[model samples]
Target: MNTEEFNNKFDEGQSMVDDLDLSKALRSEQQLTRISIDFPV
Candidate 1:
């Protein structure tokens, strides 16, 4: 469907999961960076 149609469905709180095309969806890079911290009591 077009953008307007998609927006209407989303605005109406309808389910749009089935209308999505994720065949080439990209996976976000989630590399974690470690941090060092010291706390004094």
Candidate 2:
């Protein structure tokens, strides 16, 4: 493939990684809320 195609693919992969990171962070926050509610402080 060409340089442009490689750069596009790399950008897409980075975007996917960012999306996955955000999803994981959200899920973690939700789980923490649930745990705090269930256990109390």
Question: Over the stretch 1-41, how does candidate 1's per-residue lDDT look in tens digits?
Answer: 99999999999999998998889676789668899999998
- Which sections of candidate 1 miss by over 4 Å? 30-41
Cα lDDT computed for each candidate against the true fold: 0.91, 0.56
Taking all chains together, each candidate's TM-score versus the true structure is 0.55, 0.32
Q: How many residue pairs clash (N, CA or C atoms closer than 3 angstroms) in each of the candidate models, in the order given?
A: 0, 0
Taking the tens digit of each residue's C-alpha lDDT, what string does model 2 give over 1-41? 56786679787775445324455355344553333346657
Position 7, candidate 2: lDDT: 76
Question: Which residue pairs in candidate 1 have backbone atoms (N, alpha carbon, C) closer than 3 angstroms, thus clashing?
Answer: none
lDDT of 2: 0.56
Candidate 2, TM-score vs. the true structure? Answer: 0.32
RMSD of each: 5.9, 8.4
